[model samples]
Target: MAEKYRVGIIGRTDRGNYGHGLDSVWREIDRAQVIAVADDDERGRWSARSRTGAERAYSDYREMLEQEQLDIVAVAPRWMNEHKDMMLAAAEHGCHIYTEKPFCRDLTEADEIVAACEMRHLKLAIAHQTRWTPTLDVVKREISKGLIGRVLEIRGRGKEDARRGGGEDLWVLGSHVLDLMRVFGGDPQTCYATVLENGEPVTGSHVREGNEGIGPLAGDAINAMYTLPEGATGYFGSHRGTAGDPSRFGIQVFGSEGVVEFLTGHLAPCHVLRDSSWSPGRSRKEWVPISSNGVGKPETLPRTGLHGGNVLAVNDLIDCIGNPEQQPKCSMYDARWTVEMIAGVFESHRTGGPVTLPLKQRENPLTLL
Candidate 1:
């Protein structure tokens, strides 16, 4: 019998909680066991302990880390402010980490986390579940086979609800889109963006504390463009109250020969239009559905939903732990690049021009405004 990896979970209850079922998902992984849980809130701690079937619960995550001999730590908070500390603590304890997204508050925090993990040779995976979806592999294969010849552009957008539109949407939901952008379009070379608040450009006075501890934020509408590899361009935009009927919140990869569109999820809907004209009206082509197996094939993965995605991510982390050469589909470096992309939007807006990649400013750009 193989050794079962002992996992410790960290949550903050009403404050970000066990992000997208990060705690309970461990129950589905037979190779791992949830040994303990930590949450500052008393009720949340006990409730988490029950939910995860953890053997113990602690009020302080630091205390939990010190006492428990954990093989893995789930930094389950959706909130970004606590991510840096929680991740650092996990690394210090020599435990691998699987955490929620929007990696951290800024590039500086992201850099620190990456350095720590790299120093300890710890494998860290972020929950950019879309990257782990089998459909993504099919999409990539199709793109490579010239189904979408010479990918010219990739466009993505957020949910753009009235509340979390623009900057907030960019940070929260945009992270997923940005990650996919890199997957297809390659590393961004430069970003130029415009941020607006009430039909006008955002200024320092407009900046305020964002929800879920995202630090200073401004703008209710954002239009950003990135220069991707091989002359491919990427665009991400969101506006307050502008979401569509079915929610126009996904990525569309446009190529010289055709286009591929996909939503965000482990089993996200994907379609391919094999038309060189790039228009259904001109070519009279049909959009073909894609599944986990291939275009027009049925999904083969036994599990689905966010829970299923967590299982895939956790399994990848375990695999990477056993094989040091492999990295998770949503590796820590990939998560940090998403942060840099989000920061570039603000940095570009602040400078009123294009900002280069690997942003020189590591702090929140809104603060500098």
Candidate 2:
């Protein structure tokens, strides 16, 4: 019989709680065993164990790691504060990691965490499961088939809802947007952005600490642009209380022949507009839906709600763990570039010019403001 992967979970109820169902999703994986769970809060630990059917629970994650010989761990807390430390601990214990989004506070944190995982030969998967969703593969295949013609530009936006806008919006919602831009446009070569608050450019006074230990942040509105390695240009924008339409909070790929607009969510639908003019009334063609399996109506998809993405991500981790040469869809290296994209926006604003890729500023760019 094949070995069942021993898995542990780490969470903090006070800080985003079990990270969008990371604890429970492992239960769905046939080859995974929920061996133990840890959370700094006593209630969180108990709740996680109860939900996951974990064999043991602890209030301190380090203690759990030291005691359990885990093959994998879900660093489930959404809080950035504990992310770096927890991943480091798991790497030292020689366990693979599956963690939440917006991987860490800054490029510096991403660098260290990735290094630790690499040195230990551990596979680290971030919870950016949009990358794993098969529907996206369909979208990419369509793009390559000239459905959108020669891709020329990419546009993206954050949730920009009332709950969190500006800097918080960028770190939280923008991570997904920026990563998607990379998917369509390739690695960014340079970035130019303007950070704003109350319709004015953000200044040093506007920079402040972020929620859930996201680290220093600035601006309530952001307008950024990037040059993709493929020569396509990418744009990202967000503002407070600007949650226009849920469908609008996604990426659009423009090509010389047509355009593709993608909605963000689990198995989110993508549409193709064949009219090169882009303007609706002026365009000669209409928007049509693309599916994971076919070209028309979306297929009946799995129920991949909040926890669903985690399950898909975990499955990929398990597969990659067994095949050392294969990389998970949302690998640690991909997460680092996402962080760099976020930081580059700020660095561009600070420098009053475009900031080149692989940002020179390793720390949180907002801190420098």
Candidate 3:
């Protein structure tokens, strides 16, 4: 019989909690076993232990890490503030990690997490579940096959709800879109952005503490442009109270010959429009459905939603652990790039001009304002 990988889960009761069922997904993986769980809240700790079928529970995650011989640790909290410490602790214990998104508050934290994992040769995967979806594979394959000829531009938007619109939306939801932009548009080279609050340019006075422990935030409307390699340009925008009926929150890839559109879910619908004119009315083109198998084919994956996506991600993480050469599709480095993109928007807005990638300013740009 193969050795079962021992897993530990970390969560906080009402604070972020076990994000998107990260703890429960381990129950579905046959090759892994949940050995312990940690949550500061006594009630939440026991609940997590029962939920994950963990043998033990701890109030402090650091103690759990020190006691358990864990092979993998799921830093399940959705909050960004807990991510850096949890990840570093896991790395120090020689355990691989799978954590929720909005990687960290700033590039400095991200760099520290990256360094710690690198030092330990630990594999860390972020919960950008959409990247693990089979639909993305089809999208990539179609783009490569000239279904969308010579990709020219990529655009993404966030769920601009009443509360989490603009800068907040960019950090919380736009991270997913930015990851997709990099997948299709290549590495971003430079960015120029504008941030506004009730029609006025955001200034230092506008900065305030954001939700989810995201440091200093400003702006209720944001528009950003990025330059990618090979002449591909990227754009991300969000405005408070401007979300449409169907929600204008997804990605669109425009090519010389056509365009592809996809929403932000593991099984989100994907469509391709083939038209040289790039306008459906002018060219009489219709958008065609794309599936995991291929363009217009049926999806073969039995599972769906976050559970399904986490299954795929965990399986890949296990494989990467053994292989050492492979990396999770949504690896830690990809998460870092997503953070950089989010930071670049504010950084560019602060400077009133374009800012180069691998941003020199490691702190939150709102603070510099």
Candidate 4:
């Protein structure tokens, strides 16, 4: 049996957890023991220790790193504030990483974080579990098989209640959407975004709706769009617009031959699809039947409870650590691109202009004035 990787969780409860679900993903990943947990909040520390059956809990993450000799550290809550430092600390401690999305609020910090991990020769995996989704994997493979003809426009959204998909919609919710876009469209060429934080009626009201269990976000709603390398196009819409209504959330993908409607509610279901043959008048357009293998090739993804997505990412991290040749599915470079895409959204909204990718002015979007 491969030696179990001993892991730790650093980050407190009442600050930046964002209900991210990392606490559970860590528990479900196999052979990876939770040895320690660190949280400034007394309640959070106790809660984490209770969940993982860890013997030690610390008020400071660095102290846990110094004492535990941990093999992996999950920087869960509010990772943005300490992204650079936590990564460096994990590398110095010789541990692998499984961090939250919107890797960091700052695009500039991306290079530094990537460099630190590379210098230490440590395996780093961002918390982009969507890469391991059974459906996603299948769809990607099918696209490669030329079933879709040629990839064209992709449209996706995360309109679940704020509990599922709000708060810094781009950073918290947009990470998954943008990752999916990259999967379908490849790297983006240019990005120009304009968000309406206020919904149709509440233009200036800060009552963003989607986040139900998580907490309130500063903004109301968020929307961003992208342009692809081969003239392909994509769009993303996220908002807390409807607090009382049922969650309306999912991805709608379009290709030359067909379309895919994959929604995450009810455990992320694959819905309707229409091929090139379909028309408005016809009851049955050339239906491109979506099969499990066709979604990307049917396969059972790891189910580690609600946070089942993390199991593959965690396992991959362990594998990467053991094998020098293993490259992560959500690599540091990928994380950087995701950040740039997100930053571009903020830039566009702030400047009222389209901020292209390889953004000429790369700066920290979340830095406080």
Candidate 5:
């Protein structure tokens, strides 16, 4: 029989409610038991304990970590301000971590968390649930088989909704597509970006505190372009107070012979076009939707929605932990690089040219503004 892994959950209900069901989702994952929970707020702590069926709860996460003897801890807070400290605490206790995305406030924080987890030889999985989508594997396999020919370029977008657009949308939504781009074209070599406010270039005054502790942010509209390793171009854009008819928010891979488009969020569908000209309207080929199992009829997904994706991510964590040779699908290295891509956009805007990869400025670029 497999050993039951003791799990603890951490949250701050005042900031984004237990990281979108991350705490309770562990109940659906096998070999994991929620034994403890912690929250700064008295009410939130009780709520988290009740939701995760934890045997005990605390008002301080550090206290919970020091007491629990947990094998795993769900650092389920959406705000980036607390991520680094919480991750460090979990690492110190030799607990594997599954945390909310946007990784951390800056690359510096990301480095510390990554190093701590590495020193402990523990698995650190970011909550980029799209990496766990089963259909993504199918899309990757198809790409490997050259169904779309030689990959040439990629385009991605954020939701560009009424409430949040531009830099905020980029950090919140663009991070997902950036990760997808990495899945397709590895890490970007350089980034050149143009950021604007009211159709004019953003100035230092434009910088302001971002939502949920993401850090200083600027730009109400942005267009960032990148050069990938193999001469492939990448584009990510978002505009404030403006949206398209269909609300384009996903990644499209353009190849020499065809194209592939993948929706942004977890478990979103993907499709392939075999037209040589890569024109959907003019080409004679049809767009075929690919799924986890087949082209049209998708296989029965294990769980539904974000909870389902969380379960898959937890499974990957467990699998990686059990198998010494296997690595977590969304490892700490991957999370740090994802933050780099986001920060590189601002660095490019500041320098008036392309900013190279493995950024020199470890802090949030917006802060420099």
Candidate 6:
């Protein structure tokens, strides 16, 4: 904490605090103090200023970035539409960033966000906090140790919510599921997609208008599969069903010896369990707590050290800047596959054919993009 990093937070009290835990995370870092606050809504700005008590208040995020000599900027906005612009400004000033999830709304913007940060030699860490949970850590360790035996196959899905309706589940929640897949499968060699909204394909003629914004993005579900470099096949489904709609968000990993079943997100009503050939009493297995620590030593910060390990992502970004020699465990480039994973599903639906990734062309078709 010797080298304190000044920060400016582009935060909103609404939008459920960006769903990344930054509202409270800043309190844990003695070395990190928010020096400014900004939001388009005046009330949101007032709330941010009162919460962080920054010396300066702004209604425009770009203006704040121009004035504040910040070491880091936390983009904690509710929607993904503004992330590209917000982040690029931060990178232009040579500041690192901690952005909210789904990274960006589409592949076109996703690439821009990554390139903007990389061009400035800055680190970009998405708010996929489950990557740091204690339960998830155990799962990763077990997978590395072959606890699940040969690591045969993997699968996961999302429950319903307000954000559930859009075919963008892949963008919203699929990022988390796909990221976990990458953790186990390494880089994917090829990808295949199948998409449905309420179990139907979306076409250009059948425009979808959702996201609380007018557009053709409100598809209902996204389902896709990928072939990992190690020959492991992985699958992910982001269905916008209902919050309390008897939905389960978790991973089912099959292996020769055992299996690791992971529940997605740190959200409430979580039911994480594990099963294997090794049997038990009446139930094949017992309920296991889900958690995640640090995977690799991506930075000089103590393994699970920064942000007191609570906001693992924010801490990881700090460690990335503090220890430039070490690469972050997650990066924007590492996340493109996630976009590819979702887009492939849409492509499959749009073209009435199975979509492929490592796409050969690597082009985006979303006209709005």
Return the top candidate by lDDT: 1
lDDT of 3 by residue, 103-185 (tens): 99999999999999989888989998899898998899879889988988899999999999999999999999999999888
How displaced is residue 29 in candidate 2, in Å?
0.3
Alpha carbon deviation, residue 334, candidate 5 (Å)? 0.8
Q: lDDT (0-100) at residue 79 of candidate 4? A: 41
Considering summed lDDT, which 10 consecutive residues are worst modelled in model 3? Answer: 295-304
lDDT of 4 by residue, 205-282 (tens): 443322322222234456677888777888876666453344445566777776666554112556435465435255
CA-lDDT, candidates in order:
0.92, 0.86, 0.91, 0.67, 0.86, 0.65
As for candidate 3, its clashing pairs are none
| TM-score, structure 3 vs. true | 0.97
Listed in order, each prediction's TM-score against the native is 0.98, 0.97, 0.97, 0.82, 0.96, 0.83
- What local lDDT does model 5 show for residue 229? 78
List of clashing residue pairs for candidate 5: none
Cα error, residue 363 of model 1, in Å, equals 1.4
Residue by residue across 52-90, what tens digits does model 2's lDDT show? 999999989999999999999898888888799999999
Better of 4 and 6 by lDDT: 4
- Superposed by TM-score, candidate 1 places the C-alpha of residue 88 at a distance from the truth, in angstroms, of 0.5
Across 1-369, the per-residue lDDT of candidate 5 in tens digits comes to 239899999899888568867887888887989999988898888877887899999988899998888998888888878889999999999998999887888899989998898888899888888898988888888887888888899999888887779999988888888999999888899999989988888878998888988889888898999899788999998997777767788899999888898985567768888887988788677899888885666667653778778888998998888876677898888999889999899888988898889899888777777
Better of 1 and 4 by lDDT: 1
Cand. 4 Cα-lDDT: 0.67
**Off by more than 4 A, model 4:** 17-19, 26-30, 160-167, 197-221, 239-248, 264-267, 277-281, 285-305, 365-369
> What tens-digit string does per-residue lDDT give for candidate 6 at 1-369?
337888888865454353455555776777788788887778877777877767788888788998889988888865766677788889898888877766765676777877887788888777766666555655676668765578777776755456664465556666777777877777776666655555666555545554622124646666667777666788876656454445556566767665566655542112233445535464567644333432221223334332343465667777878776765556676666676676666665555565556454344444422
lDDT of 1 by residue, 81-136 (tens): 99999999999999999999889999999999999999999999999888888888
The weakest ten consecutive residues by lDDT in model 4 span: 208-217
Ranked candidates, highest TM-score first: 1, 3, 2, 5, 6, 4
